[model samples]
Target: MNSKWLWPSIIAVLLIAIWLYLPPGIDPVAVPADSDSIARGEYLVKAGGCISCHEGSEGEGGLSGSAAVESPFGTFYASNITPDPETGIGNWSGEDFIAALRHGRRPDGSFYYPAFPYRAYKGLSEEEILDIAAYLQSQPAISHSVAPHELPAWVGRWQMLGWNLLADWKEPGREMNDDPEIARGEHLVRNLGHCSECHSPRDALGIIQYRDEFKGGEIPDGHVEAIDAEALNSWTEEDLALFFLIGMKQDGEFVGGKMEPVIEHNTSQLTDADREAMAAFFKRGLPASP
Candidate 1:
C-alpha cells in the first residue's frame, strides 16, 4: 500500500464502521390489537413525538405527507408514516420498524438520512420502539403519497448512504436516576424532547458535535439555534416552561424557527409537570454563564 493512500483508506474504513452502526430509519411493527399493547404504544408515541413531523398544517392536508420541512439544503416534505397500506409504513413488520429506528434503513433496505431524526432515535430501547410502532399502526392510516426529496445535483441521493455511514449513532437509551425529578427531566429531553437533534451542531459529515456538548450550534441545514447550556441558563426555569407551552418567552418574545414545529407538535402537548421537569433539568445542567 502506498503511504500516500493510507490516510484516505483509514478514513474510508472509519466511515464504513460508522455507517454499519447507524440506526435504520423506520420501525416496522405488526399491527397489535391487545388493549395493553395499544396503551403501551400510545405512551411510546407520546414519548417519541411522531405526530410533530408527520401531520400537515392548515391548507396542507393533515397527515397526508404534504407538510414541508425547511432544511438548509432545501425544503423536504415530511412523508406519511401512518399505517396506510398504499402510501405509508402499513405493510411493514415490527422487525422492519425496529431496524429503521435503531439502524436508519427503510423496510426496502435503503439507508435513511439523518434528516429523519434516527440520529436521536437510535437511543430508543427495543421494547419502547415496538410500542411506538404499535401506536403508529393504531392511528388512522392516511393515503397521501409524497414525492421523494429533490436534492441539488451536487448532492446525489445515493451520496446520503455514505454520509449515513459517517454519522450513524448507537448510544443506549436515556439513563434514569434515583431522583424522580431529574429522571423525569432526562426522559423528557432525551426521548420525547429531542433537543439535541437540532440544538447541537453537525460536522461536515452531518454527525452532531458531541464534544461541544450543548454549547449551541448550527444545524446541518445551516440554521442557527442555541443549545448552549449557558444561553439556556439565562432563562429562568419558569421562563423555559412558559416558552415551551406557548412558543413565546415570558417577556413576550416569540420563539420561532425550526423550533416552532417542535413546539407545535410536541412541547405544547406536554403536561405541565413534564414541562417543569424539562425546565428543572435544563437549569441544573446549564450554568448561569459559561
Candidate 2:
C-alpha cells in the first residue's frame, strides 16, 4: 500500500462529512403504556411475527435477538430486544422504539440496517407502534448480548441514507381507502404482515422491488413461492384463509419449511378478521402492476 495514512485520512474525511450532514437531534421521550395497551401489543407482536426473527436458535439466545439473517450485503444478527438494561433494549424510551421503526434509526439517529423490516413498519400508526412497544415492555427480561454485524466497506450510514432516498423513503402519511375493511386489510398486509420482505426480490443494493412484490424470489436459504395474484389465481380467497390456519392446500396437502413456524407462532394466533384481511389483500393483488 502507498500509505496507511491515506486510507485513514479518507475515512476521517468521510466521517466528518457524514457528521456535518446528520439529521436534527431528537430527544428521547418515555411513554408509559397501560395494561390494556400491553394486551393489545401482544396481539400485534404476534401478527408482526416478531418471534420468528427475535427468538434465537435452540440454545443461542431468547427474544433478546441472536438470530442471524443472511443477506446479500452480509449476515446480520438480530438485536437483543428483551428488557435487559445492559444487553437488551430495556433502556430505550417509547419514542426510541417508535423512532427505530419509523426511521430505521437508533435513539442516537444512527442508521439501522433494513433487515429489521423497518421499511414495512414505517407506515404503522403511532398507536400501533406504541402498543407494540408496550408489549415489549412486558416481556420477561432476557440478558442476551448479540454481536454487531460486520457490514461491507461500502455500506456506511451515508450510503444507507442515500439508498433510502433513492427509494423515495419518507415518513408515512397513512392515507386510507373509502372502505374501512379494505383499508384495514391493506394495512395488515402491507405494513404489519411484511409478507413481501421474504417473498419479493431485492435489487443489487438490497432495496426491495416493490413493483414485483409477492412474486417470489430466492432468499438466503431457499426460494419462496410466488404469492402474487397471477401465481395464486387458482387458489380462492377461502383457500388462502384456510391455508393460514394449518398450511393446508386445496389438494389436502400441507406446506412445510419456514412457513410452518410462521403458522404456529404468528398466523394461528391472528383473529379471523385479520386472516380474512390478508386473504382479501391477496385476492385484490398489488395496487400497481409488477
Candidate that would win on lDDT: 2
Best by TM-score: 2
C-alpha local distance difference test of each model: 0.70, 0.79
Instruction: Assess the local accuracy of residue 15 in candidate 2 as a C-alpha lDDT between 0 and 100.
Output: 100
TM-score of each: 0.78, 0.86
Model 1 lDDT per residue over 1-290, tens place: 99999999999988986665454444344656667877887765655666677775564454556566565666677778778898887887888877777767777766666667776677687777777777777778767778778666576545666676455453323445666876787767865667777676667655777655466666445656665667675688898889878999766988776677777777777778888888888887444553
Candidate 2's TM-score reads 0.86
lDDT of candidate 1 at residue 36, scale 0 to 100: 80
Model 2, backbone clash pairs (residues 3+ apart or across chains), number: 0
Colliding pairs, model 2: none
Off by over 4 Å in 2: 1-29, 59-62, 169-175, 285-290
Q: Write the per-residue lDDT of candidate 2 for residues 1-290, one digit (tens) a residue.
A: 46978999899988976874475354565555789999998899888888888886667555878778888788899888788888887888877888888878886777788888888898787788888888888888887779888678876765667777766553334566666666777777778878878888878877778768789977778898888878887888789889888889889998898888788878878888888878877777345333
* Cα misplacement distance, residue 24 of candidate 2 (Å): 5.9
